[model samples]
Target: MFRFLRGLVLPEAACEEANSSSRYENLFKKLDLNEDGRVDIAELHAGLKALGIPLGKDAEEKIFKTGDSNKDGQLDFKEFMQYLKDHEKKMKLAFRSLDKNNDGKIEASEIVQSLKILGINISEQQAEKILKSIDADGTMTVDWNEWRDHFLFNPATDIEEIIRYWKHSTVLDIGDSLTIPDEFTEEEKKSGQWWRQLLSGGVAGAVSRTGTAPLDRLKVMMQVHGSKSNKMNISSGLKQMVKEGGVRSLWRGNGVNVIKIAPETAIKFWAYEQYKKIFANEDGKIGTVERFVSGSLAGATAQTSIYPMEVLKTRLAVGKTGQYSGMFDCAKKIFKREGLKAFYKGYVPNILGIIPYAGIDLAVYEALKTAWLDHYASDSANPGVFVLLGCGTVSSTCGQLASYPLALIRTRMQAQALLEGAPQLNMVGLFQRIIANEGILGLYRGIGPNFMKVLPAVSISYVVYEKMKQNLGIA
Candidate 1:
């Protein structure tokens, strides 16, 4: 069941691993700039960076020496293979180091002692929780097989690579949310076919937005008018939209919504990479906090760049019949009548919301991923699709919970003028009105529809993104 779930949620990694050896060979060839049969220190350094493994100078030198078994100052195929073999051996020794008394299995007590030596400062209960995950026999002890399978699949030998991969691949319950690293791999960067990443992201965004357009439209309506109209709900909102503009009204703002996805995603991706470069350490690796900061800044940059489209989208959605023919008309009318400030009505809340939503979402996801790795993952590097789904669901749920009120306020602010009889409320004024008129719960108006969209949206985006990458021949 676990294997099945993993295959479902993380098929990309599973399917891609089958061709990993070939991919590695191809990667090696790409790194061999001079077409030499052996790889020198310079070539190896370049190759690791190309593979997204950024080592500091000393670390790089150490890796080179480790691989050059014959003291040849470079790595031949034999030496390279030996180095790979040695990495596995070193990891096995790490496992043994945890098993005190030369025992074949590790108990919770052993875990506590080992973690203490590393200054982890965990309680025995926490140690037991960690052991419980890989305790296949339910004896509350991790046997040789369990220990080996749990840590052996990871390929990084050096601490830098280990921490980097751990930060990227596993989620850590680090109390607060941080950013998830970019999904693109080093091989994808080396391919110089960058458009594929943008294409995949754009397609994923489009598909998610389009598929959930109706719910989105409904949510907008509810946010703007639900407090005034107590009868408003999902079904009534749908009926109201159809009555106002016809069944097609459900997608009134979809054009602008879809239009902004490509550039937004591309810009965010680029900004994120640049930010990563900026935040990276001497080893060319970034910590989780750095990743979160980079991601938040990137999101803010993308949001600011494409904010006008968001305004246009909201206007189109909230517009009454004959108010505007299309998004262009809506944009033109807003610019001409309301001026430039109109396009930025909800900009502050929107930007502010990104921090909590992205931060909490990222943090929770990393925490969940870390917990699963600590507990359930053995043999398989991935905990599986179900685990991914759980992480996303929980993270998104928490993020939405934290940011929903702000989002509601932003939506109301954006569409305030569109509703003829509605009062114009600034950020603080809007919060006051909502609280006084409809109570705190009013702040969560239309959240049901909003929450309903999360699962399908995330699933579609992830699955489509992966499929598109494969179809585009991205490594």
Candidate 2:
């Protein structure tokens, strides 16, 4: 009698298992959008769109070409899985590399060494100061678990959450709650709205450029020469630069950077708005995944158009003493030397980085603003300075961390053109060089000052922009 009942249950169990397996299998199959047993460019695009994951044209091409095995131009289930696995592996490797001693903890020396490798010119004294600020325990070394749990993965202080909050609050009209009136004439559309975007973007561009120019110059300098060299510290570096080339040297790439700013910011904001509108409902609410998808897509789109200028800007910023007199000269020189495509030398990592950086940065900014307005601010129209500062700090920190690796790659590629007799610095060459010279830790240089810089800059920019927009009633 027992055997008979067991037999019946066994068949039912097998059937249930089969059903569950089939469901997962189907889901994996969907990831292969082209149905070619792999996910190709079209398939990846369709699948990401379906899943609300945004992939720019460049990213799609890179992923398809690399992720697909056998050059079949598609990503089979195995290939897709492998790509995900590889990402996880890299993350794990990053964590491991950060944990210098096999003792599973990160020491001050380890962190300092990591920065040194990435071309950041931080003294051991500075690293010690940073560690003391973050480390509450008297422990001289931070453990891997502690580094991850407390520093990298702390939920209360997660950079991703902070960034999302900031983005949510900063946008003029998120979701469908805000609407532009259709009664506006076409001329008004071009002259009024377009002009506002352009002007605002120009302001943003100018502010961002001015705020970052010095630091950008310093960062490129450190990357070109080893960080241990004399011109690594900010004040010392600035002094040396001025001494060598005069005060004007500090603003080496300002011309191009300033010009690029208006269109870059305008396009980025516009793309972000358009992308958000496409995916979100009228109420301005979207699921978490959808927000990520939209933000990433928007970032990729914006970066693609603006990237050439960025390359030129970087080249101008780090070239040998006086490579080109001005932005136009630099552009002409690059065109003549490397052809039109040279302007987009580091296009790959840049696009990939922008997706996450913009998406997370915007999302966090909005979220932080919303939180501040709801809990802390007496009025949404005029949140306190502290509230804005806090929001900016959180949002920028998250955006930088997520995009650090790509930033490293971009800086390397941009500086490559200026390095005499240096081998071409593709992504692979950059990574290998970093690994060989500095070990795995070479990829996160300048992250400390970068974090410090981004927080204040973004925070101030957002607060000012928001106040200006509100005053103008341009939302």
Candidate 3:
């Protein structure tokens, strides 16, 4: 594993530094950016800048004069070798200086102090974030081996480059592949990036839900009209929608759907991050079970917060054209007629569904991620796109399947108040009524449309999410 990480970071550093014939080759290649096998003063300056080493012109000139034995303004292999020896000696001294306690490791405070000396002002939080990246043993400190391996190839130290390399490093077997991106340190949770993460999640959710809006409308129609005179099958449902309000009708209720997604995703993501912190162990590691619990709680919290939008969405989907003009109008009518309880009509079943839905979803996804990592990504850390899609689709499907019946019940309860002469039923009464009227299979009335939408919806969602992160330079 150590050798694998070294290869990813410094592919040429195979042999130990104690008895290596070509120890300076990787260093030389880094300095020789054009790969001309020679290090010019310009290349050296750029290399030092990349390494976060601020060398003044005079200091650079001094090194160039000492290393350029041939006096050709460039250092050949042998000349570069001499420079490399001096560079390592300097780095060793610097590392020792930072190891203030002489414990052969750099702690967060020590690193912060060293950075301050270099005119870099960083909080202890930032210091720990940096150390945690290189801390291989979970000790939250950088050992000599880790320190040397990290700086072996003279990796970039600028914040932008650091983030990029950190993400790139995930593609290599530097260590475990289960590092949760959403799991935040105490410091990072309060950082500006927290808001950015929430915003990204909101955008991803909106895009995914909107992309699947047609099928979502179909699902609602099937759930409500499957047993009515409409006899809503997918084909009939689509036809009925177009007949009613044209192609645009296919996206009925999508406005509320899209609006609800932003807050739902942002709340869920933020809550999940917080819950993970609360549930994490002393080591600050959250296990799979804890993750599932956190996800379930987060889902429920988000659902409860935006549940009125869900109710409004359902009413608009099943309502006739003259029934409600928009989401606000729908909410106004529901509140005026049925009071506040109308907005939470299906609160029982909706909240109930979160348990199985979130539990199964998270459990299945984590299991699949672990399986892919163990089976295929054991050799290479990052799995292929197809693997991720397969896992996401299957896991989401299984989760939806487990909770679909409850979701159908919730939808029915939410829309029940809108149907004239239909009795308002409690959770148990609704279950019995569905069973008596449409049989047990009635609970899964819209399942086909729901299933049909899962793959594409989840695929697009994940794809957009990844692209967004990459674009934002977060990934």
Candidate 4:
């Protein structure tokens, strides 16, 4: 399968210590940015960047650590050659798997078939996009020599690592509970790691929401009752809660919010995968537009499915402690008094808000991650956890800002029936009434509390999510 395997992929004694073929020297020269006899971490990363091969922080770090066997913080030519030789067998096996039909070359169709098996759908054009990166002779496919040469310095030993190195951004948790469901490889799904990931995410989300429940409650209160006549800023809002029901009342509605995380996470994950499968282009590639569409649709599907919980969360958040004993009492009262449809009180605006929020969130996160990589990638592979948290926070905040007006409307509509003498408004009527009565600023009434909770929520979610993933063996 690897008929053109270079001498560099041979035993170290034979390829490096015994010989100086131009091929090995040329490859080493590509990685030796300072023209020294060895390659350092920065040079390795820069060299890979120059090759148009992008890798994530973890992948880049792994390559460097594994290759620098002497603990010297650098790779001499011999170490470089030895590392390549050790990894060549694995890379060769990966190539053979891609070279379906045993043709000794990887074609676009093969790429399509291979990825489909891995649960990723890409079009022929997308597959060619992959090939064009590795295809040197313009043959529209990759031969053994092309494959080996392209990946000789790459740290990925298997197809999966290669996929990870190329398909970035899904790396860090970013602390956004509303993030699109992460893509899982077919192997992970089969091994049952998918559930562990979802569980970790759900636990993280639950912890985060609970930690910020008071702020969330305040935000809901502000959205439902904040007005020109009754100015309920954070200070007054919090003080009112303590006066009415004491400190514990701040977490009045958090139980239901925490309870709904599991189902919502699972639904989103499953729906995202299904939507990707359905919307993929001819080459099994999901384009930017297609991905956004799938993600939005997946988000909507999950939101719609768990919408009852949204109504519950809103109702509980705005209610006084003595008004409803707990989530079950609140739900039972609503079901009996308002009928089945009460659970979907604000379905319209809630669904409408998903597109802009998901789209902006995805776009901003990508831009920030890309910008970070461009400016500081050579300095260090890992951007550090705080950097990731910052990116996620800004992106999610932007999303909330873009969609907050609609969110406020949804919360109000969901809680409206509980308020005496409140106007019953559809999505449009709510918009008109809010603008007319509360002014443009009223639409952002609860935004202070909502934003106030973001940093802590993000920090808690990120920490808990990482710990959970580690405990669950979700590498």
Candidate 5:
């Protein structure tokens, strides 16, 4: 029933619990603080933390509820042993379910066939990729011992429990909106966590955008007007805005910017799902390459549909104070003066930027996450919030660096009509002008403000999402 289990392995534990009673005893003793010969919740947490197996409050409670069979508040040595024994039993059963030939070892073909029997068809190549992940020693197959060791410390009691561990991760709106949207399990859709997570992310994005609107506007201004004759540093730019509009104009187009988040997120996720289905093989599964392709296409679809808003945001961001009343007024004037095509002025460069931006962002984020889980997967594979934030920031910054010039060109295109004496330039012409006029470094005109907002925007979004999720009773 849990289709997400098709490829995923459990928490990578170091212990090799293969009917080793002494090993189990040694583990129990480490957790049984104060020599009580029984492990309490506090002692369990401390022991696990020492072993790099940090647990949230809910995870600890679930462990006690499942392992403490006598309704006692603590776990005795027997209870601890039973927990491991039961966990091992579950792992073995999963392995057996996939080892269709009853060959004691699991092959890629068996995994694909097993999942197919259960109506979750995946390709042999996809199954092989999954096989390589858990296959010890590059044997390309998983024996009982190899399968057992992969999940020795896993707290899940069954397939459902195992996948439930990943549910917490789906809500993290990591990196920027340009990064791929997190995919939800089928269970998440049925359990109603998917919509809640989206809502939480949407609200977080709104608040974070609102909080950092000034910096965003300034970045747009610097991109549009920063040149040798018109040198607009952050300080001079903000002072100019304040001088003209009395300190309130800093967030000029924030309303439109915030309004676009809900639709963009909704469309992106919807389009991703559709693309995933459309690109899936005959068995209704796709590999990593196909997945990325689908994700990039989905992002393009969303950005294309919402390109008008992009143009509006650029216009308002670079517009003079009281030039147009608001987003609607700005749109109306642009429509009258420049026709409907004006709203899609920067469409080409914006779409082109998404390819490099989403590609590198997704690539680096996956690489970093995989490296972390492979090398440092301790008691739980779930990364700490700070660790996740660090990974997201680094990958996102790298993506921005790769695609910054295109983004600058897009902004320039959007604001070209409004700029007096500005020549009409396509994406390539604008790039050439910037490089020729301001040197190569000119391609990164507003990079300072853009980078400055990323950390706080990401941090604020994360904090706000957590609070909103709690308030919405997502747990």
Candidate 6:
């Protein structure tokens, strides 16, 4: 009997279209209570009520007035299906129009255009308002899935209703929505600002120095003697240094790195923010391409100012023994030994690498943060510690992948001082040596350590900086 019943109920051909049709038919039958093949007022009210919606007499009257096309005080299944199909068609058309690139994705630019066409003038604030409403993944893009789920799959058929629903959605009300406390006084704000600046400086410097240290050591080892064996590892390299020069050798040129970090990060962050603000909507949100451009420009600006210090740091880090005493002595010796141009020996590759590295890093971080929040914390107002950590990891990975080759070249150029009477290696010489001697793989020798250094260093830096800013109420 059960088998017979199942056979009777289930269709033989179970294709997607068949399943969808079955679902629609089931829905129709469920709504058409009393086996009447039609939905009466009582049946509609009961259905709405079952769904936990209050459909009082007044609400029923309004629904009947709009949905009852035949003026029969009832809804036949055909009429109801027609109404739903028409609304779905309209929504699909609207979605297609908004996805101007026809890439099946609605970008922020498309949203801006769509809003304009809908007769809504979107100011920067208004754009942010709308963007925050629809950007489910926080990637700042409004792909079809996000648009459909967040905007279209609702009983609110009109644009106004959709907007209203979005305005109240949990996604839009996250971290930035809460009201400031009355006890947050002016003195507290000023003190917080002071501490924030200090913290930004300290954290930025520490992260920069730490990230460069491993790379500095690896570059020196490779330049003085190529990474032919397992001795290229950090532990092995340290052991070699201890045997030759002593414990102090490991910290070679650390002073230059520490000193350079402050200016490098200060300039980089400041420039990044400025460029982001310029290209972004006035409310300080940007699209993916805009974010990339802004970050690249910022990196270029920062690297230009500090590339000389980078060269000096690398030179001091590498070598046999006693090439220079410390950061200051290194600078003096480089000036005396090689011309001032020696300080920028590998400027080309370094500058080029900075463009992709910074842009990809920042963009990936923001994109990952949005993705994690959307997927894991969609109902919450703030991302937890894990989300921030994941974002940092993603950002570091993208940056390192894009810039590893250039990093190798820069290291080689800087460590060229180890070679007896070797002239300053330019971009060409560095590339040739790396290719001819070690094959292509030589260029990515310390990638594992590079990623390890970057991931934690960048992750901690950003997480700390963001938390500090949030705690201090400095958006």
User: By TM-score, who's the top model here?
Assistant: 5
How large is the C-alpha RMSD of every model relative to the true structure?
A: 12.1, 23.1, 11.4, 8.2, 7.7, 16.7
| Clash pairs, model 1 backbone | 6-384, 6-385, 9-385, 133-375, 171-366, 171-370, 172-366, 177-363
State which candidate, 2 or 4, has the greater TM-score: 4
lDDT per model vs. reference: 0.68, 0.56, 0.67, 0.76, 0.75, 0.57
lDDT of 4 by residue, 10-107 (tens): 22343333453555666779769889799887887787666555655555666777778899899998888777777777888999989889989999
What lDDT is obtained when candidate 3 is compared to the true structure?
0.67
Mark the regions of model 2 whose C-alpha exceeds 4 Å error after superposition.
Answer: 1-198, 227-231, 277-288, 359-385, 455-475
How many clashes show up in model 6? 0
Encode model 2's per-residue lDDT on 277-388: one tens digit a residue.
6877675544445555655665566667877888887888776567687778888999999889888887888777765665566567666655544454331123444665
lDDT of 3 by residue, 340-398 (tens): 98888888888887777655655676577555544444233335556656765676567
C-alpha lDDT of residue 132 in model 6: 60
> What would the per-residue lDDT of candidate 1 be over residues 341-385, giving only the tens digit for each residue?
999998888888888888777677767766775666554333455
What is the Cα-based lDDT of residue 174 in candidate 2?
Answer: 11
In candidate 6, the residue pairs with backbone N, CA or C atoms under 3 Å apart (3 or more residues apart, or in different chains) clash, namely none
Superposition TM-score, candidate 4 onto the true structure: 0.71
Error of 5 at 18 (Å): 20
lDDT order of candidates, top first: 4, 5, 1, 3, 6, 2
Pick by lDDT: 1 or 5, better one = 5
Weakest lDDT window of 10 consecutive positions for candidate 3: 168-177
Candidate 3 RMSD to the correct structure = 11.4
TM-score of each: 0.66, 0.53, 0.66, 0.71, 0.73, 0.54
